[model samples]
Target chain A: MSFVRAEGIFQSYGRRPILERVDVSVKEGEFISIVGASGCGKSTFLRLLLAQERPTRGEIRIAGAPPATEPGLDRGVVFQRYSVFPHLTVRENIVAGESFRTRWGRFGGAARRAALARADETLARIGLDHVAHQYPATLSGGMQQRLAIGQALAARPRILLLDEPFGALDPGTRLTMHDFLSELRTETGMTVFMVTHDLAEGFKLGDRVLVFDKPRWDPTDPDAYGATITYDFDARNGGIPFQTPEETLHALRTPGPDPVA
Target chain B: MRWINRQPGTALRAALVATPFLLLFLAYWIGSEIRLAANPSDRLLPAPGTIAATAERLFTEPDRRSGQILLWHDTLASLLRLTAGVAIAAAVATVAGLAIGLLPHVRAALAGLVAVVSMIPPLAVLPILFIVFGLGELSKVVLIVIGILPFLIRDLSQRVLEIPRETIVKAETLGASSGVIALRVALPQLLPRLIQAVRLSLGPAWLFLIASEAISADQGLGYRIFLVRRFLAMDVILTYVIWITLLAFLMDLALRWLSRRLFPWAEAGL
Candidate 1:
């Protein structure tokens, strides 16, 4: 069986649909990047996979089990903002990554020491060891995102969900984060699903890229429709060269007949 | 040298702060001198020396009937009532605030009621509290809790709401249960805000405590001050007022220090 199976998923708010009849299957340890126009439900899809939200119709299965009713240890997520706990030092933040594994979400004595050791190792791997004693606020934005990623990875989750995790970072920092993520995935061999507006980023990081879009737009009743996977590209096979977000969006809006077929 | 141009240094800032107090003391001293020259026994504004003497007596001398220093007894009594009231309010507010902030049903049910309760004048219910709780320590403590509880609950709930949705979702994805999210995730962040809310509530808390004490209490700072008011003992009243102000200032400082020491990263943005 596929590691993650989402079948005929449909999500909506009130009468306004966000995702429509979406289906995708991810193999174990595969990295899939989802790119879409703004407000095209890319993040919503990610939230569904993380089980932060339930699909209104159809079902998702992870590891042969039904999709989790709520977010759990098997799925770790890093958002673009407020991903780090400000009340904790960097070391404590990393330790908090394993909160779900411990009883009552806390580590004590030997477990605490072990968690700290793991936190230190994660910090070192993320090149954040020097700021271990510092608070997330004291770190630069890139460092904070790195700490967030480290914290998410510390849980040793089966899948890592990134909702534009590097969207807020500067160009230079974004490249560094891309490399860091690539290296971390290679080392951990964990499945990754990232939703981003940056087409180049999606192409660079993903082994496969899924484009979500509205195949038909009714300008009179815009809210009547929702996004679905319209284009699937094998990024590693050089199916298409990288396109700017604007160009990609334009293409999605004005697709040729039988675009998906 | 250029006072208007440059920001004050630490020592200068300290001196600048002291300047107002010094000027106020001088004005009081001068006013007392003028009043005393007109009439040697001016009860409305006692001489600074008389106020100082009252302070010395209140601090050092014991009451003839009770054989206990009145100032210490009053201070201790007032502190006990304040501590009990604030503790009860804080505990209740924390629990209720979390429930209202995190759970949509709870928020929908209670938010409006809390808002309405907060709008009712706390002092207006002083008589009702006395009628319900009677003329005892229970009444005084209960009055304080009633006065500050709504405000604390509202402030803390708002603070909890201000916590980023991402943080809570992130915690959940880490396998944290709802209880764990409330305790481990939300509570720590709310503590610093709780301290802040309490600090802001101190003035009103004291107002309720003193109002309750003044109306009916055998011993308390407010009781002592009101007890001597008939004799126009301004010196004793002034001394008590200054002492109360000092105590309030100290409490605020202590809470701020505690918040910083306990959760240094709270004020630092995530």
Candidate 2:
């Protein structure tokens, strides 16, 4: 059985459908990149994987069993912004990631010293050791995002989810982050599912790139039907879709930006 | 238009800030001089010198009847009531605000009720508070709480709600329980905001305290002011009013300083 499976999942808010017939299966250590136009329920799919929300229909299984009802230690996630806790120092944030397993949600005495030592190690790995005592607000955007990623990794989750993790970064910073993420992925051998609007980014870091789009469209009622997986490309072999990305984007109806995502 | 947009130099800006206060004092002095010239013993507009003398006497001399310096006694009493009311309000608002902001059901149940309570004129129920609590310290302190509690809760809850969903989700994905989230995640973020909320509520809290004390109190700044009003002692009244304003201003300054000192990270967004 696949390590992660979502079979015929559907989701809707009130009367409006957002996602439908979203089926996917992943091996234990696959790097699955999800890409689509805005408002195509890419984030909704990520939310389902995180177990932050339940699908209106169907179920998701992890390691041949039902996924946890709530977001759990098994899955770690990073977002484009506001991913790190502002009140905590960078080192304290790393400690927080690990401290979730403690009985009182915090460490004390020797245990805290051990956690702090481990946090320092993680900080050095992320190249944030020098500013570990500083709060997130003082850091530049790229550095804050780096700290966010490092904080998530401290928990040692089995699966790592990245939602447009480098979308807010500058081009220069984005390149460096990509290299950093790739190295970390190789070292940990953890499964990663990243959502991105940048097509090149989707192909570059992903083992398999999954595209989400609406199969059925009603121009008069734009939201009548929801989005689903339209293409699943094997990105490992430099396999590009027959249609260029510009043509593909131009063909789809973008109905403005995705409000919920 | 150019003049309107023109920025003032630091020294010029300081002068501009002082202009209104200087003008007001000049006007008051002129008015008092005119009143005194017309009638040798004018009580309504006492001279600034007379007011200053009265304040000094009130500060240093013990009261003939009670053996307590009336000014200090009244100030201590009023401050005690304000502190008790505000501290309780802060504690309650922090917990209630976090709950309303974090939990969907708590918000659904309490948000509207809190909104309605805030809308109801607090002073309109002054008599009810007095009757229920029976004209004691409790009634006055309770009045301050009722007057500003709703506003504090609303401000704090709104602030909590403003915290990004992404941050909360990030915590959850790291396996933080609800208790852990409340204590480790939400409370630290809310403390600086709680100070801010308390600062904003100070004016209304002071108003409620005075109003309640004016209605029924043995020793308070408001009570003292009302007591001297019967004899038409403008100097005494003016001194107490100035003292009250100074106290409120200092309290606001202290809270602002505390917020800055404790949560330097929060300063960046502001």
Best by DockQ: 2
Q: Compared with the true structure, what per-residue lDDT tens digits does model 1 show for residues B20-45?
A: 99999999999999999999988988
| Model 2, C-alpha of A8: deviation from truth (Å) | 0.7
Score chain A of model 2 by TM-score against the reference chain A: 0.89
Model-by-model DockQ, in order:
0.57, 0.60
Q: Which ten residues in a row have the lowest lDDT in candidate 1 chain B?
A: B261-270
- Tell me the tens digit of each residue's lDDT in model 1 across A1-261: 599999999999998999998999989988899999988889889989989889999788888996689888888899999999888899999999886555687988998998899899889899999989988888999999999989998877889999999999999999999999989887989899999999999988898899999987899998789999998888863445454355655686675542221
DockQ value for model 2: 0.60
Q: Report lDDT per candidate.
A: 0.90, 0.90
- Model 1 residue B231 CA deviation (Å) reads 0.3
Q: How close is chain A of candidate 1 to the true chain A, as a TM-score?
A: 0.89
Report the CAPRI category for model 1.
Answer: medium
